[model samples]
Target chain A: MTTHNKIDPLGPGYEGVAGKELRFRDVFRDTLRAEMNRDQDVFLMGEDISGGFDRDTKEPLDAWGGPFAATKGLVQEFGPERIRDAPISEAGFVGAAVGAALTGLRPVVDLMYFDFVTVAYDQLLSNAAKSRYMFGGQTRVPMTLFARSGAGTGHAAQHSESFYSMLAHIPGLKVVVPSDPYSVKGLLAAAIRDDDPVFLVNDKKLINLTGFVPDEDYVIELGKGRYMQRGDDVTLVGMSYTSVVCEQAAVQLADAGINAEVIDMMSLSPFDEDILLESVQKTNNVVIVDEDTPRASMASEFAAVIADKAFDHLDAPVKRVTGPHSPVPYNKGLENAFMPQPEDVVGTVRNMLGRD
Target chain B: MEISKEKLEWMYTTMYRIRRFEETMLEQTFKGNSMGVTHPSDGQEAPPTGVCAHLTDKDWIGSTHRGHGHCIAKGLDTHAMMAEIMGRATGQCGGKGGSMHIADFSKGMLGANAIVGASIPLAVGAALTAKYKGIENESVGVSFFGDGASSQGVLHESMNLASVWKLPVIFACENNGYAEATPAWYSVSAEDIASRADGYGMPGVVVDGMDVFEVYEAAGEAIARARAGEGPTFLELKTYRYHGHFHADDPKKYRKPDEEEHYHERDALKNFEKRVTGQKLMSAKKLKSIRDSIEQEMLDAVEFALESPMPDVEALYSDVYVNYSNPIFGLR
Candidate 1:
């Protein structure tokens, strides 16, 4: 593989222009590069991250850039010292990231797939999440655990899963699920700089999704939700890539004479309850779209929140459109059916509105 | 490799302090002064004392559940540790982490892990940091785990990673015979835990953990190699835990009645005292004075812990994140 020339995306010519859009992966790569350049303490470590290791020569022939090329060309610029590749040892590397975080360097550990996190859950939960609190506020684990979540890429159950809910259930962890390129670039930069352990779940389905991303460094504050579109008839809450589906569903609902408010729930753990409650209070009709399975999902939690706090103001019951409670099927048709589609969101919202 | 009289005295005093601290903790637990369970490192003090002797505050060390010995040897304030065990706010972990999770980052003790072999990778990560920052091999990361933790897959992974990366790390396994109730003989497939290090392309040395000098000699070589950018080493120290796994455990059910007495005869503290005094390295009067001072120090720690107040109820919601507010359910 030939090395690609590094382009200064943040150079004078490229500011926040409407047509100057970047793919989700490019946005992520640019954000990481900017962070590494900004802070000497930041580094990346994972399996085959700085790829193409020639065993005979004992040298790297090429950098695969990461499984999805989210870290492409970084090794050539930063060199192997900053972009390290590890054996297929999740616990060893992720735990090492936690250890490194405690000692000063901010490490961004890549969990190739969110499903593979189970292999290294103890390190993330027992060590990374608990270290700060267990150490009596004397310590901080400023590590970013980056992983690809959601299904639709045909990688099967082991490779495709949106388990951000499980991580969001954890208390000392900040879970960020940016829906588009713009949000991902800013949210990732925020996570890397944050003084706590942040789990950045990039949706696999949104890897190629493109949008206008600012060339300059920016950070979207954690626990804050953004509105993609404003309306009043019904409130639609979507997380990660599902926010696109929510936006599409809102457009469909608008054509059918139903005004829908689309709110992108960017951060999950310290969830923006105020914005959600305000939206629910305004619309009184709500539908939560999430890719995770039904039970114990972020969608379910939002439904519970509406029922508990805004129950009296509800026009109807809070509706939830989530993936089925089962492993993501390998077959194309079954996998498509398992994931929450825009039609599912439209149908759920329509049913809640008594228009079905 | 000849240890000076002053260094030997320091080692002896630290080991004795650990012994007395564990003993006092056991007594306090029985008296209901200390809360939660404690896995005392009663007879297994030499491994941490020796390995940590070669390390400074710049170097990092990850520990296991039986970590009081490691913490004490790494220069943690005995008063803070005692307070922590008693659940006082003045404790090392602000009373949040009782005995098992005591950590003082200021001293480079990366907290004791309750999970087996969990901290091995952490030490490797710290070493990775030291390497990344180009510390010129001045700092190293040391991970101390029991023989039981050696069976964990992370241990082998860590060994291999440390070797391949040439990370400045030392994997110290204190083979204390038993992993809770199960014997290492039944659990471990290998005859010696350190021997497994050879499979990962690193030096594996076994030492008599009951002898501090032997441990110090072996550890000094390994630590020096690590600081010189020579990669990692897996050192297994053969030791014994005289007490049960935890405060409430009964070792009588698992082991033979004579086993405890056999280990007691070769207790690390007693054996070291005998060897040092017998060789005229230090007089018995000097040793007694050291013991007396440590005894009083432990007493003062206990008193401080008892007098300290419990953490405020408001502290529960704090420290979960550096900036974000973690509102407890039903409380807000």
Candidate 2:
């Protein structure tokens, strides 16, 4: 039940009211508050989300506000009925969210860590994803499963890993991975309003990262890609946290006199194949940067799509800069090596260009 | 809690409807007239009928794989259920769900889950939705599962949630004496499955599943408590399944030779018939007419299912999502 009296202003990315720079987490909380206020049907449920449970009193106190504080001050605004604090039961609560969505409510459920999805895999895949099709279109599960992903936080094997690719493989799901505060606000709003099941994978590393966002509610359409920077030398496709890495890599490429085009693939399932193909046709050389492991990754899918549709337009073989095919290490040094960095993307793009 | 003549009559008819529907499906599957697998609730009608009789379209119920009885009790159209089992486009789920996944959201039957204990959480969610909406609606969510589901962690989790939140839900445990081929005595360590509810801070009651009146009374009390915002109640209906786990299964391989006969003597339908007649709540002639009508209704359902057309190829991709083209490569 903690409260911040100071009014935080908009961040730097967007052209909006001049105010304080908002972090990705603050933007997410604000977006959720706006959505909850806009639609009475919208509600949230997850472990420690309400931050009501007090360890000392053994009674619900007004604050723990979720593990990451993404839902801070929400219980006070919406009350406990709308801002539910669920027990540590992933399968139970996730299944309940699907059922609730199917009936009449638009629920936003938290998976805590993206890796915890394995525990509720059946509910997400079988019940939530397949229910509409299996039931012959009789119902729709309008729910958003939100979770924090990426390996940089050093949460170790169980907590780390970006498995949005696995969820994207399912037919009925819409997967969104936003890299910054602006995209997080817009994409999360869109997911909440979607009539189908949407997975909003927030990068754990980007929680404290600051960016400019609007003060009002807005939606960025799912499956659309945006160009962070454009050039004809080569196209660098990055998703989620890796998009930030690509921005850095593009800077390094620019320093070496290599004009590179950077494309952020924010949505993975209803991915912008047209944008990828058009970019590859223009640049002829492409390097895909992914935070997930390389094998059967979204990068692999994009590479295949490129080879299949834009093979004749290629100047050189497509390259993939991704995490290695191994578990995310717990040690900071090993974990850093386990994940892809800007230098890896820079070197991959330079090598693709046949430059030392 | 006084049982009226009309309510008793409806209960008898509801039980008869479930029995006839399941029996017809069983016979059809044996004759190769039905598509996919079927889990018949031939001898287990009282629990669903009694429990669902207390519910309405505003209330929701989650069912198990052996769910035809629950669907009927929950007020789903017999023709749609039959068509669904037969994989016809006219079915409730448009032929996609088949037997194991039959659902009619319009009637608040939240579909039947093949995975044991899966629907418990779903019912809890529905109850949470009702609670969130406020108590003026008095809406309750009912979840029906087998004894096998008692072992699932979800059941405990859901119960704890329902209890803690005081959400309006009824955890109906239909202990049909077995979890598929394994006997409940072997799988469930507790002497009574109802006792497990004590751990979750809720009322635990066991009802005679063979007697419809007993189930009706117990379910009524639980439903009342839920509607009054007293939280969830766990009702363990001591029942039995006359047939195998599914139509294709052979019960003899796993059960005693006389087990079916032993349970059949106090069968739900038979006991209901005897009690209603003895109490003069309904005459034998009236019960006969009700039974005959249900029989004809089932016959018509089977015919409708047989005559209905299979779903079109275009429907293969429909209903996967409200919008957005599936982007999985090669799936299209």
Candidate 3:
């Protein structure tokens, strides 16, 4: 998903950019700071974003800087007024975020963990998502919400989740999944600027992974997926961390004398179906990988789209490497089994190619 | 609490407008003109009329299911409201939102939410915006819910958020005594919902919903305090609804005869008329003229709604998002 400095998403005439290697957490924080500096209306609200307040002075301590410290050092720079910390009440704050967005502000709320979205699901789905449509286009809820998601972390069932399909299933809301440092930078900026409510699901696995990030203010368009590697043997589709899994599988399969093209569907809800379809149309074999549970997953959705639109091009039936229809456990081996790994996609691709 | 001659006239007209609007809307609902369920806010008119009387178009208000009164008080056109109830393209929300979801963002009326206690945070959010922009004196947030919504955790959450941030918000809880068929006595844990405000650390006042002047004065104080950066306030307006929860619901099934009689005897509109005429703040003839004018407005609203056309099929897909990259809604 890293496109490098040559292609600044701020688009054209702004080239000669420098590059640096940074962790996803740093990129997330830097992007927040950049957006805040760029737009005065942009503010943040989340539990533990500022971590703690002094007993007497009530100054932000930035103790934890939120889970994974994704928002570290932001409070000190933006001040507590702009980088506001919220209470444990998810529904209350999320609802307030929607209202704030409606009333004229770009509110980015850190929902902590993806699984915690259920607590405030009504506000997200009912007000933030549906307000514009339901109100007959009277208002636009320009809200951006993010949270850590994925099963590889030992957060157990309550904290680890990739149920973005539940959000993607919604009509009005937009859902984006950034794979690495590069994707997070561009996508976060884009999500913040987007007028509609966009939920960016940050996989916990990618938070610590360092990758190439351009030293340019840019935004990768939402609903667009880029080709990581182009091959004709099979098209491997991935989103969020699974994109990383697909890239790994593509490398492994290439070593086995098999060529596979990897497509990272950055935006899930308004998904980059064309990228998947085009890759499938050319490659004739496709394998969709996802970390969410199997039933009604994004992998299945991509498979369905491929099957429906590119049936003639398919030399083999579309296969999916997805998490089992079970909760992610805390056990190391069990958690590993629950997520769609590089080996799983390699095996599924091999089976589809009849080369195993 | 001092009432000016012009302000008194506007209040009287606004209350009468709400009263007639509800009655007319119900009549249209029974006449098979309304597309969906309609929640009549006949008896609980004073809460919105009083609170909104002090508000300008810059101030924001979040409303509940029974939101006709709030819409009328917020300066939404009756013609569009009627058309919306009738599910016409000319409605406030282009017929997409029925009676429960009509909104005019230009008027700072956050859409009327259908889910109980769902719109509380919206008002708090609006106040957050005002406060964020450092415009508290010019804009404030007001949340309108019923006794049914008093128990919702979001209400408590919103109150705490407003008080902590000292956002310019007013938590206006209309204690109409019934959430659907269940009475507040059975559902509400507290003796008075306003008492819960103490826990949230905001001043809580119980007002007579039947008296427009009382609601107006109390709301004025709260709104002023919010505008003055003093923080949020909780107002429990003791009110009642003349009709059932929805258009077809019959109150006789759950409510006792005396309860209905008691509320009707102390009707908000009747008391407003009596008060104005008794104090010589307004004349009986002037009040009658306002009533007569409202009667004609109701007739025109109904006629406009009946004559309006249904929305195009494409409208179903339109307005879903400001800009969705995907063109088609259905499957490939």
> Comparing 1 and 2 by TM-score, which wins?
1
Sort by lDDT, best first: what order? 3, 1, 2
Q: After superposition, how far is residue B308 of candidate 1 from its true place, in Å?
A: 1.2
Candidate 3 structure lDDT: 0.90
RMSD (CA, Å), each prediction: 4.2, 4.0, 2.4
Where does model 3 exceed 4 Å of error? A1-17
| lDDT comparison, 1 vs 3, better candidate | 3
Per-candidate DockQ versus the true complex?
Answer: 0.82, 0.75, 0.90
Tens digits of per-residue lDDT for model 1, B21-125 = 999999999899998989999999889999888889989999999999999999999999999999999999889999999988889999998998999999999
C-alpha lDDT of candidate 1 relative to the true structure: 0.88
Candidate that beats the other on lDDT, 2 or 3, i.e. the better one: 3
**Number of clashing pairs, model 1?**
0
lDDT of 2 at A205: 88
Error of 1 at B216 (Å): 0.5
Choose 2 or 3, whichever is better by TM-score: 3
True contacts preserved, each candidate? 0.85, 0.77, 0.89
Tens digits of lDDT, candidate 3, B150-215 = 888898899999989999999999999999999999999999899989988999999998888899
Error of 1 at A333 (Å): 1.2
Quote the B-chain TM-score, candidate 3: 0.98
